[model samples]
Target: MGIFKIEGGKQLKGQIQPQGAKNEALQILCAVLLTPEKVTIHNIPDIIDVNKLIDLLGNLGVTVEKLASGSYTFQAKTVNLQYLESEAFKQDGRGLRGSIMIVGPLLARFGKGYIPKPGGDKIGRRRLDTHFEGFIKLGATFRYNREDYFYGVEATQLQGTNMLLDEASVTGTANIVMAAVLAKGTTTIYNAACEPYLQQLCNMLNRMGAKIKGIGSNLLTIEGVTSLQGTVHTMLPDMIEIGSWIGLAAMTKSELTITNVNWEYLGQIPNVFRKLGITVEKRGDDIFIPAHKNGYEIQNYIDGSVLTISDAPWPGFTPDLLSIILVVATQARGSVLIHQKMFESRLFFVDKLIDMGAKIILCDPHRAVVIGHDFKSQLKATTMTSPDIRAGVSLLIAALSAKGTSTIHNIEQIDRGYEHIDMRLKAIGAQIERV
Candidate 1:
């Protein structure tokens, strides 16, 4: 674990670029196993989780070549299937939740796939049932080992079929899509997760010779192909990171321009921040957030109810950015209820904000009511530990707008999602040090 020592009450001004989407990278990297030919990828964020997956791919005998700073070419012509049973693989594969997606491509190509219990942030009960159930629906035999905590799926040949998922899980949809693309017949997936990441995956697969329809909708149709060829794919900018920067600029009283943000894909994110009375200017493809010198005010509902910010599926405010929204609302003029409907434990980080003098009530595991101080009372800096990826960045924002220096332990959580976060913050004049 690492710690970040931050000196607060600094007004920053500059332009920053959002990195490649982390969620998308996880899906796209695993999708590399679908083809044996060279697949080149660009704009890959050099973060911990992504690098871990890349390393896991290399360990599985995929030839990986770093073409440039954010470009890599992957070829999986000679994969060592025997390594899947090794203890080293079990240890390595358990580090990321995205590791589950690898099973789909492996099972499709090799007729069998094995995975240890995958690990991720303790935000909530993220069920893998959706992935496995989708596999079973596609004619794969699923088996789980209780003692080893491993999951295996195998079939002589997968047959594509119609599946209406219980929930629109992003990785689950990606996994089943990968499997269905090489199956025997057409697969119709209703209630699919159609986020821009999935759209990009579908587009890339289409370029690779997989026939998929419905690029940006909840229903996806995939036609099983004999084999997919290699193709080049570039990731879009990270919308969650861009949203975080917007909240950071308002809370810290900074004028920051987030460059190349892929405005079309950032659904409701800008409007969500604007509802909190922050000024968001869209200049072409960039977003310029001016420093809120007079402080921001929360806009109440038409019925005079307290503002409620909640998370939902794509086209709704992402649950990942609700933490940032909660932290930003602490300095606003009115109260707002942040309902983290997707995760049960994510709202607990508000207790750290209360420790820093922000008035927040933990209504429950899924909800927090924030009473903004209107910048009349500055938060007092204190020592805290980061619990997860989004919460870590939210705490960082709080510390930057606080009255004194603060230390945040367990900064590895932040590093997993953001690439060179401290360096990026420093470039925009934030006083943060990795200690």
Candidate 2:
């Protein structure tokens, strides 16, 4: 129930290092449960969701020791899967979608997995059918009781086969890949999500004895092994945070430098932002944003018409970042239509933007038309509560550019992803306080 009070209209200027990706860290932590060896992870983000996963793992008898600020040593040498029955474990595990990932690893190693309904961003109806379908294909039986979903694999030997996912769910693909790595035969997964996070998961699993092919492609081939050993790996810097920082610098007209960004894994961030007229300068592993004075120009079609920003599967503009980019576009020069095909309710938060003097048209649950203010900063401060991770960040950006002080509650939602956001923004001259 915390709130953030921000006095707007200040330029942010500083060097900020993006933290480890929360999405990647969540699955890698669950991978520790697959083996009873010591696993050391470096550059782990100190976020709410990661800490909750650690607590859940500890409840299941995994020994998680914090070695440093962004480093941890986890040993699931004696994990008791029965902790799933405990209320504390169930509540914490139900807090995020990544918790469902533990179901696959636990079932693969221990022959049984218990999971409750997951709670995450209410962006859309995210289905767990993909996870269950993959599980059933790998010799697992699923039963749904009144409240919880139970999965049991009574087969003495799990045999891998061909799996064609119904949709390219990011976490669903990761869950199935983890389960298939310990099966008996070779597993072929088609239509898999190939995000950078998924690539990291595959690489980490390979380092631990699992053979996976097509690292950054949609089709994945996993060669099952008897067991996996422990290994130490460093996670890549967060790409979402890099994109969030870029949007923040662009909207507030700030000069900022993002350090330790993985230039090779930028995906479509550069091209997408360039469409909205944002310039990014790359110097080695660092990216610098100059003080943006003149508002950026939107890209027009070849026939001198308006263009749109839409989200697609991997190797396309990520749906996770559309909300942030939309907010940034509101402060730019021209107009663009943001099409969110993956989620039905994600674009609904734009009504709050409309309340703050932004000219936006809610075309449908999946699309919105945003007209920029052409460098005008007439947004008035308002009281609002964060809805989700990306939406919360977008609202924060709107709050930062508003004319007066704005109060946003439920900052814990924002903390689930961004690392020490208030402190980092303070270093860059933005006046934000946690109360």
Candidate 3:
């Protein structure tokens, strides 16, 4: 229950390199269980969730060696499968949603995988049906202990099968692909997630001897391989954090340079921010945001109607940054509609902004209309509790742009996703301290 005490309304300046893609790190880390050789990874983000998963792996007898900050080597050689039945495993496995991903590789390499119902941000009703259903399609026997809220998957042999997913779930696709890579035959996954993170996993798998095609497409074809060897993989910068920094610059009217952001993979983020009238400049893989001294403006549609910013699958705007976009829009020159299509409770945090004197209307559980203050009135700083990861960062951004000091409690939610966020903000001239 940490808290962040921040003195707001300061223009920040400096370069901030986003940590490794948190989403990708989760899936990639879980993939290490597919091989027995040493898997070296670079740019591993130092965050709570990722660290928890690393600890969970260590608890399961994976050899983890820290090479340096943001670098690590993992070897799952001689994993203790018996630990999966231990009470420690139930408690450790229930700690994060990413723990569910370990089940796929465990079922692929070993014979069984068991985990308690995973925990994560309370943003919405995140269902595990997709992951389990995909595993079942690949010939794994699935069992659920409703009384204990535990899940188990076991298989003597996995035979690949074609599956058209009900939704293009990134984790689901990654889990199923991990299992299918070691299956007996070819597996075709239609409506798969083609996000850059997933592509990184597929690419890494290919480098490790798994045959996968359609690298950046929704339809993935995988030829089961006998075994996978370990390979080195470097993660891309977190696009969500990059987007968050962009929103921070605009909201605080600061000039900030986000270095090494992997621009090509940042699909629709810059364009979507530009739609909010924020200037997004690309400088050699780095994003340069100049001070918005005169404040930014939201754009209207080509038909002169109100603009709507919404989230979709890859190549569309990410829902994770919708909260940031919503906060940035509060200080823009015009109005925009934010539609958080993936989750219902994400928009609930707008009330906190309203309390800070912003003009926002919660249209529904999933939609909100933001009318800019145009800097004519500054948000009055106040005490707020972070409800979830993205919302917490959004509130932090709001507090950074406010007129007075603000107190943000439950900053552990922010720490779960961002690596030493207060310290990073401090390096960028932001007045934020963990208290």
Candidate 4:
């Protein structure tokens, strides 16, 4: 129920480091349940989602120890599967969609899994059908009783088989991977989500003695093993956070040096930003943004016309960032059409942008065309509630660069993803007060 009051139109300066990837860290935390041995994860972001996941693990009796800042050691040596039915367990699991990943691990190790509908951002119709389909293909029988979804598998006798996922649901792909790692026979998962998060999961599983081929590609072949040993792993820097920071700097005309950014995983981000005329300089592992008084311009198409930035699956501009890109497009000089194909309601927040005097056309539920009026940013402070994590941050960015004071309530949604976002923004000269 907290709110952020921000005085905008301030150019953020100085250096900031994005904490670890939220999606990757949550998936990795569930991987800890795959083994009873100790697994130490470094660079873990202290965020709501991650904490909720940790709470989920604790409910299952996993021993978690917070070491230093951004580091934690987990020992799930004795997992009590019975706690899955607890009201507290169900409430926390339902709060996060990542809790579904635990279903596969629990079913694989304990032969049964039960969890209510998982919840997270209410962007659109996020289906668990794909996850259930993949698990069923792996020889598990699913049952739905009123609100509880249960999976009962004779896991000891379960045999791995080829699974072609209907869609590349990120968590669904990861769920099957965790379930297949300890199955009896070989498991082949085609059309898999090979994002950096999944790659880290594979790497951690490999260290724990799971045979997985195709680290960073769509098709993955997993050879089942009898048991997995504990291993230590560190999560990669959050590319989405880095991209968000890049967008932030470009929008505010601020010079910021983003440190510890893993340049290797940043596929297509540089090109995507280039389309918006945002220039980035690479200084070793860090990216430097030079301040610009004149707003950035959107690169035109081959016909010297306005361009469009749309979201696609992996190896493309992520849908999760389409909201941020839309907000960034408002400050650019030229026009660009932003598309949010994955979620039906994601483009709804453009009304807030339009209220800030941005020139935007809501083409449909999933697409919005933004024309940069380059309005003098005469933003009057207004009270708005955050809708989702990405959209919430986008609004925050717009608020920081706008004039006057703006109050954003329901910051817990924003806290779910970005780590210490307000504190980090304040480091770069953003005037944000939490109430």
Off by over 4 Å in 3: none
Candidate achieving higher lDDT, 1 or 2:
1
Residue-by-residue lDDT tens digits, candidate 2, 146-236: 5464433434566899989999988899999988999999999999999998999999999999999999998999999989999998999
lDDT of 3 by residue, 198-258 (tens): 9999999999999999989999999999999999999999999999999999999999999
* Clash pairs detected, candidate 4: none
Candidate 4 lDDT, 200-258, residue by residue in tens: 99999999999999888889999989889899999999888898998889877899999
Per-residue lDDT of candidate 1, residues 1-435 (tens digit): 799999999999999999999999999999999999999999999999999999999999999999999899999999999999999999998998889999999999889999999998989899999999999999999999999899999999999899999999999999999999999999999999999999999999999999999879999999999899999999999999999999999999999999999999999999999999999999999999988999999999999999899999997889999999999999999999999999899898888999999999998999999999999999999999999999999999999999999999999999999999999999989899999
Instruction: Report, for every candidate in turn, its global Cα lDDT versus the true structure.
Output: 0.95, 0.88, 0.94, 0.85
Error of 1 at 427 (Å): 0.9
Clashes within 3 Å, all models in order: 0, 0, 0, 0
Provide the lowest-lDDT 10-residue window in model 2.
Answer: 147-156
Q: Which residue pairs clash within candidate 1? A: none
TM, every model: 0.99, 0.97, 0.99, 0.97
Look at candidate 3 and tell me the lDDT of residue 168: 90
